[model samples]
Target: MLILGAGQVRQALDGAESEVVEAVRQAYRLHERGLTELPHSVFLRFPDSARNRIIGLPAYLGDDTPVAGIKWISSFPGNVAAGLERASAALILNSMRTGQPEALLEASVISARRTAASAALAAATLAPAGPQTGVSLIGCGVINFEVLVFLSALLPELDTVTVFDLDRSRAESFAARCTARLPGLKVTVADRVEDALAAHRLIALATTASTPHLAVESCRPGTLLLHLSLRDLTPETILAGVNIVDDADHVCREATSLHLTEQQVGNRDFITASLGEILADDGYRRDETALTIFSPFGLGILDLAVADLVRRTADHLGLGTRIPDFLPG
Candidate 1:
């Protein structure tokens, strides 16, 4: 077995945005082609902590080089209040040929990177061609931070960003961090969610809002909304848009913004198409008169794909610890 720590995983993935996005794109294609199996993510919630839960995602990506894995990830929003990261994760990858556990690796980084890659990939696919000079990020969290990191590669022409968080200080700090990481980008802290939502045509929503808050009128027409957090928009707002999701069944299960839209409408007629379908074909057209919401339910295959990449890269770079005959003889 090979063991990869968080630091090692980070090192292996550093500056590999293009590769990671390609891997995520392949995973999406595999899933769309019915070459992947994804069980609904299992959630473990604590009665005492309504806002926190741990999720287990099990998936198999079938292709010429098949892979299977499970990601165990925990999210504790209060951790940010305590000056700690709000999420942590671990992944166990198994060899498809022998059914033996091949590697155990830190997964929070993998999770974040894949997520950012997916969002960036979707943006690159759906967004209109022009100057990507401005973007609005509605949540100043780790997820959006990573989104900006990938966007730096995916949309290098972005010159302005406006960010907002419930906690203004956090938003300000996020801006400072972005200014440092992405030079020549003007990062501003928005005082209101509506202000942030309206700051740019390309909007990213990654807040931890437990329930619906955003309304349909918050954004202008033709807005490309990356609904990363999944629970930030109201049912009416979700139904009012041209929705694109990673997976319809998965996104509609967790009471995400899109799920809420489904619950209210009693159908998924509003969904435009899966992101994979759009990525697979260049002839797909976007309705520029409507708000385009891309709400990804965070697929397990994405984690498996990114984790496999990290494992192979680490192996080539001699970056992880190898444990010989640890499972059984």
Candidate 2:
């Protein structure tokens, strides 16, 4: 098996945001083609710790790219206290024909970038046609940071950003980082969630909160809420919006945003359409007056898309560790 480390993954992803977005868009299109088999992610939760226990995502992408991979990831929010990353992940790609492991890769970077790419794609597709002038980011962690970068790339009208985090120091640190990366974009630290939401018509939620469901009353009308954290918006908030999901079944089952709504409403009928359906031109329509919410359950097709790119790039650069022949003779 071939093993690609984090450095290799980062190198492969450098300046590859647009390609990643296109890959994710194609994956969503294939999803609408009914050619992929992606089960709802399996979650292991530890209530005692304010972090996800672990998550296992398995998927098979059909079409021109016939591949299957599984990502095993863990989240430990306390890792930041130790000066370590909050999440760690690894992915295993298997040969479709022989069912043998082909490669093992460090997936943390891929996971973050693919996710950010998806959000950026959705924003480009769903947000208003005008420039994305103002954006409010709810979390200042790794995911939101990447989201900001990709969103800026997609929506060049984005010249100002409002950031908020529970920790004051973290918010300040993130603001400084954004200033460095985006020289002209103004970055402001908001004192509260409402302040953050009200500051920008474009809002991205990437918090670690498992049960944070913000009310629509706190947001401006026509605001595009990018619920990247999965379960950050309440049913009332979601129901009030022109809701779009990556996959209706997957998001309703595992999306932290939709999970709470399903429990409260006892059904998943509130979802208007999947982003794939819209991208596929499958009779999906959007309402201008309604609040727009896009919840993605982090599909495996995305993982495979990014992983395929990484694998190909790593092969060209000779960056990954290769094992002796693992296939039986």
Candidate 3:
């Protein structure tokens, strides 16, 4: 078995958001064509703690090059206060020839990059107004940081960013980092979430909120909301937009904003199209009139595709530790 640590993973994917976005785009196209098998993610939560849980996502992606894997990840929101990462993950890819474990990798970076790439792809493919100069980030976390990076990679017109976080200090730190990463980029730390929401035509919500507590009525028409957190927007807010999801069946569960809206309306009529359908059918050339919301379910296939790329890159770069006898010989 080959073992890749976080540093190795990062080294393999450095400055590769464009490639990662294309990988995510291809994964969505393949998924739309039914070239993947993705079962429901397994959530293991404790009875005492509602904010923390571990998830197991098993997926098989088939094309000319086929691969299978499972990502084991844990989300503990309380870790941030202690100066620790909120999420940690690992992925194990199985050999297609012998069905044996071939590689093990630290997957939090893969997860974040793939997720951001997916969001970037959606933003590029769905935004009818094209890339905006200014954007708003609702949460100042690692996920949003990566999202901003990928968005900038895909849409270079984005030069201004407004950010809001309950922890003002963290928002300030996030701003500094953003400016440092993309020189000449202007970043604002907003004191109120509403101000951040109204700051730009492009908005990304990436928080750990377990419930819906947001209203989007104040935003302008044709606003692009990348609801990455999945639970920040209210059902009514969701209904106000032309909702596009990665997969209706996968997203319309887990009590997400879409799920809550479905329960409230007793149907999925608000959903306009899957990101896959939009990608496969080329989702552009439409008049910009109504609100647009892209709510991805964070599909397992995305993780698999990105992780496989990392694995291949690491292999080519001579990274990772090879355990010749990790399995029974």
Candidate 4:
């Protein structure tokens, strides 16, 4: 077995945002071709801590590059108070031919980057044409930072970013980091959530809130809202938007944004389209006059895609720890 560490993964992913986005697009296409199986993620809850939960997502990606992987990610919202990230993850990739464990890799950066890449890809695919003038980032954290990096690539016209966070220092720090990473982009720390929402027509939500909520009354009509934090938008907000999800069955079931919307509205038909269907040339039309929301439940195919890339790159560069053969020949 080969073990790829975080540093190697980060090195392999550097300046590869466009490639990752393309991989996500191809994964969606594979889904359309009926070559993938992504079941709803399974959650393991902690008995004592309300904020602690671990998720297990398994996926199989078929076609020429056959592969399978599982992402084990844990979320502890309280970790931020202790100067730690709210989420951490690892992925295990297996050989498709023999179903043997091939590699184990750190997934924190991989997960964040692939997710942001997918969001950027979706925005490029569905958002209105023209310069991407402004964007609002709801959560000023690691994920949102990476999201900005990917968005900058997809929307080169992107010049301004409005940021909001409950913690003022965090928001300021995030803005500073953005300015350093994306030299030409302007980062403004908004005083309030509404202020951030009202300033930008393209909004990205990456908060840890499990409930259905966000104050966006001041948001302009036809704003493209990327609900990267799963269940951040209220059902009323979802109903008012041209809703798109990564998967209908997985996201509209029990604990995701679509699921919360279904519980609130008492219907599942509110979803307009799935990413796969949209990529498949299904008649999924966008309502230009309506608000748009894209909620992806964080598909495992993305994890697999990044893992495949890292594995190949690490193999070529000899970057991982190759374990001695445990199974005797």
Candidate 5:
């Protein structure tokens, strides 16, 4: 068995945004082609704290580079109060031939990057024209920060970013990090969520909001909203926008915004199309004037695909510790 810590995984995936994005894109295509096995994510919640939960995402990608794995990640919103990140994760890859555990790796970076890459791929496929003026990041967290990085890679023309957070200091910190990472890019901190939401045609929400809060009254055409945090938007807000999800069955569960919307309308008609289906169809484009929101439930196949990439890279670079006799021979 090979053991890769966070630093190793980070080293493996860092500065490889293009590769990671492409890996996520291929994973989506494979998933859409029904070449993957992804069971519904298992959520473990506590009765004492409704805000904290850990999820188990198991998946198998049977593509040219086949892989099977599960990502165990926890999200505790209160962690940020203690100056700690809200999410921490680990992934385990199992050998398909022998059913033996091949590697154990820290996966928080993998998770964040894959998610951002997925969001970016959605942006590329759905909003190919790219953002003209700038983009707004509603939640100034790790996910949004990574999204900004991937967006910058995909859309080099993007020159500005508007950020908003309930905590003004956090938003300021996020702005500093944004400008430092991508020099020459103008970053602004917004006073209100609505201010950030409507500040640009492209918007990304990656908050830890447990319930629905804000929604734009209207939006201009070609608006691309990356709804990374599943529960931030109200059902009414979702109904008003064109919905594109990573997967319907997985997304319409765990009380996500789409699930809530489904419950309210008693149907899944609010969704325009899956990101994969749209990517599969080259000539399918939606009305440019519609408020198109991509709500990715954070599919596990993406984790598997990215984990495979990290594992292979780290192995080639001699970045992980290996134990040959861990399993019965």
Candidate 6:
């Protein structure tokens, strides 16, 4: 068995944004081609605390090298107040040949990076016309920080970023980090969500909002909303936008914004196209005058893809801890 820590995973992926983006793109294409098996994510919630829960995403991706894995992740919104991370995760990978677990990896980094890469990939494809004037980040957290890192790599022409959060201090800190980490990019803190939403044409919603807080009227025309935090927007807001998703079936579950939209609209016709479809076929239509929303349900296959990449990198560099004869005969 191979055991990888967060630091090792980070080292393997350092300065590898382009490769990671391509990896996520390939994962999407494989999934679209029916080469992936993904079951609905399992959510385990607490009866007393609505703000904390855990999720399990199990999936299999078939290619020249097939792989199966499950990501066990926990999210506790109150962690921020306690000076801890909001999310933590681990990935367990099983060998296809023996059906035995071969590796265990720290997955929070993988989770955030893959998410950012997907958003970056979609940003490049959906808004290929020109560089975005700026981007509005709705949440000031680790996820948004990593998103900014990848966005800078993907869209360096972006010179400004507007940020907002319920906690003003967090927003300020996030702004400072962005400015320091990404030279030549200006980061500003917004006092209100509406102000942040109006500040840029490209917006990323990464908050832990359990219910809908945003309305369709708040967004501007020709906006690209990266709804990363699934359940933050109202059904009306979702119905009014030109929806794009990683997988329609995956996003339309677990009470996400798209799921609520489907429930309200009684059909999936509102969804414009899957990201894979847009990537595979250039003829996919995108209305520049409408609000384009990309809601990714955070596919398990993504975690697997990055995990495999990290494993190979670790092997080449002699990084992860190895345990020979991990399985008994």
RMSD of each: 1.1, 1.9, 1.1, 1.6, 1.3, 1.2
Clash pairs detected, candidate 6 = none
List where candidate 2 sits over 4 angstroms from the true fold: 46-50, 282-286, 325-329
Model 3 poorest ten-residue lDDT run: 280-289
Q: Model 6: runs farther than 4 Å from truth?
A: none
Error of 1 at 18 (Å): 0.3
Task: For residue 64, give model 1's deviation from the true position in Å.
Answer: 1.7
Q: Model 2, residue 143: displacement in angstroms? A: 0.5
Model 5 agreement with the true structure over 1-329: per-residue lDDT tens digits: 99999999989998999999999999999999999999999999999999999999999999676899899999998999999999999999999998889999999999999999998888778764544558899888899999999999988888989999999999999999999999879999988777777788888889898888776764456688898999988999899888999999999998898999999999999988999999889987766777888999999999999999998899789898989998887
1-329 per-residue lDDT for model 2 (tens digits): 99999998999889888888888888898888999999878889877775557899999999875999899999888888788998999999999988899999999999999999999988888867466799999989999999999998898888999999989899999999999988989999999888998987788999887776565577777788888887677777776677789987788775476877888889888888888877867344445566889888889889998998899888888888888876666
**TM-score to true structure, per model:** 0.98, 0.94, 0.98, 0.96, 0.97, 0.97
Minimum summed lDDT over a 10-residue window in model 4 is located at: 280-289
Task: Give per-candidate clash totals.
Answer: 0, 3, 0, 0, 2, 0
Off by over 4 Å in 5: 128-131
Clashes of 1: 0
Per residue, candidate 6 scores C-alpha lDDT tens digits across 1-329 of 99999999999999999889989999999998999999999999999998899999999989999999999999999998999999999999998998999999999999999999999888888984656869999999988898888888888788999999999999999999899898799889998889998988899989999888776566778889999999888888888788899989889987888888888889999888999998999876567789899999999999999999999999999998988988896
Q: Please, what are the lDDT tens digits per residue for candidate 1 over residues 235-257?
A: 88877788899999999986787
Question: What's the TM for model 4?
Answer: 0.96
For TM-score, candidate 2 versus 4, the one ahead is 4
Model 4, position 89: C-alpha lDDT score: 91
Q: What C-alpha root-mean-square deviation, in Å, does candidate 3 show against the real structure?
A: 1.1
What is the Cα-based lDDT of residue 136 in candidate 1? 92
lDDT of 3 by residue, 1-329 (tens): 99999999999999888779888988999999999999999999999999999999999999999999999999999999999999999999999999999999999999999989988888888766565788899889999999999989988788899999999999999999999998868999998888887888889999999999887876777888999989988898888788899999899998899999999999999998998898877635433777789999899999999998998898789999999999897
